[model samples]
Target: SKLWGACRNPWDTDRTPGGSSGGSGAAVAAGIVPMAGANDGGGSIRIPAAYNGLFGLKPSRGRISSGPSVGEAWTGASIDHVVTRTVRDSAAMLDVLAGPAVGDPFTIAPPAAPYAKLMQRAPRSLKIGVFTSSPYETEVARECVDAVEETARTLENLGHRVEYARPEFDGMALARCYLGLYFGEVSTLMDRAKTEFGARDDDFELDTRLIGMLGRTMPLPDYVRRRQQWNDFARALGAFFEGYDMYLCPTAGQLPAKIGELDTPSHLQMAARLMLLLKAGKLVHRSGQVDQMAMESLARTPFTQLANLTGTPAMSVPLAWTAAGLPVGVQFGAPHGDEGTLLQLAAQLEEANPWFGRYELLEAMI
Candidate 1:
């Protein structure tokens, strides 16, 4: 079968929509569905949502099922979620999707009532910490900074006390650690493909081939070191949450980039299209730079990834938009088994702002 060239952004026809869940985010933003399914191994859902002006929640790992198909994806880094225009849509989908499959390696217990029900209630006033810096080495866009500041104002209007806060630990080190693990995982997948499916060098894109070659050369100590980094990052986040109910941040560092802005096809033509895709993955995984659509996915998972690693619940709310009219999301997260509080707070914000169910572009698409 012929592969679709690439998914195009609904907002800008010339741009590439995000992936591997780009279609979901685009469909939701276009209003084809109230919300659409998404999964994040490394910012897949949140990136697209950020690009398309929708809310994307990648709940705690194992909080939703990945069963009757495969056990764990990307060595447990991947989690199921949805991209939506409203907070309640995300809450409602969580109600439907958050559960475990029989014989699963890990599963979070279900919430007491459907998340939809909880969204109807108000939450008590809470302290929120805002962090605007990119966890990675790259620079964040000014629009993203402005969006977060606006979110702070919005939260204040909702009666929540807000303050600028930074994580106590080193952001750069955290970025390095995440990259190590991420690359290591990519390496592992490539190795498996070769061994299990007898995949040849030509079967993969250039980047995949490079990753597989690197994986073959990685020492056992490298794996152990990456695991240690995960542990350290998890501990830092746990400590950070002790003083704040939720942490707010940009889903992406910048606005969505135009499709193919990352590279021209001529530059990528040195390698096959498969290689181009692999190169794209490497670019996103290594540099954390993505097109507007790609950034939505790229920037989201780092903050959310810790939640998955630590078994905490987190959500992104479509609370603000850029001056150019692109949607901007504010993320809120809680400790493990704390979806109740998270949803309650989101619901409260929804009531206070009443921004839910307000995607005009999406409605037009239908």
Candidate 2:
């Protein structure tokens, strides 16, 4: 926007609303819509929610099918749902969209009760593991850290136990695996675009063309190997969940960046342009620069990818706003097929710390 190229955050015009769903986030946050559809592969939904202060949920794999036209997306890592101002809207929408279509691959166990009904009741007091720092070991903003810390304290006061812990996984390896998916997916999509839509090489953006080149050149074994490592992360997260009812962390490692803060720097852009010109995608991968670039790009959003790779239901709740009047969210993840619990707790949190007032004020100002 500058809320659809309205590129303005209604809360503050200079800051980003966030992306790949930033438009919807901006629209809804500005009260243009009560809710809007969104999806997450590598944190598309939650990232926007964190930056724009909405309630975003990424349901478990197979919770909602990708059916009729396609089976799934991004190796079944992406999930479709809605971002809303209230917990109830999300739960209600899930009720409408939460079943499998005929000829679908598989389905999650249906909620014990309707999620809309299930969420009205408060969850039992339970243990939650909280982590405030970036999983990729990036520098986390103090405000983001404070958001999680305050949430832990609040959870403690609400009769839940909170511990400073996280699922044990090689964060760097996960980043690499995610980037592997990126390369492969982009390559596939670009191929489709070129063949079906009669697109030219220069039709796409430079960064996109470069990534697709890497995907086209990537060896089969390498892609398969990356998918294989996903199970290790899932197992580790499952182990963590066995001891804890849920995991809590920063939805993002940093507060909303001012516009253009995440753009590729001039030096890197120069190098990438040359690589694009030479068509040296594999050379970039072999140089270990992929890891460096992936880490640098992912550092701001290192937290949300774990849940996607692990196929768990996760959410970003609008619980904290910074001193500068910017919103930053805290994330909560639940084990597979356990979105009911997540919704229940979200309902309770909604009551304990009502955020509806903030949105009302925002709507008034807008």
Q: State the C-alpha lDDT per candidate.
A: 0.68, 0.88
Q: Which ten residues in a row have the lowest lDDT in candidate 1?
A: 288-297
Off by over 4 Å in 2: 1-6
The C-alpha local distance difference test score for the whole of candidate 2 amounts to 0.88
Mind giving the per-residue lDDT tens digits that candidate 2 earns over 225-244?
Answer: 99999999999999998899
Candidate 2 vs. true structure, TM-score: 0.97
* Residue-level error in angstroms, candidate 1, position 57: 1.2
Per-model tally of clashing residue pairs: 11, 8
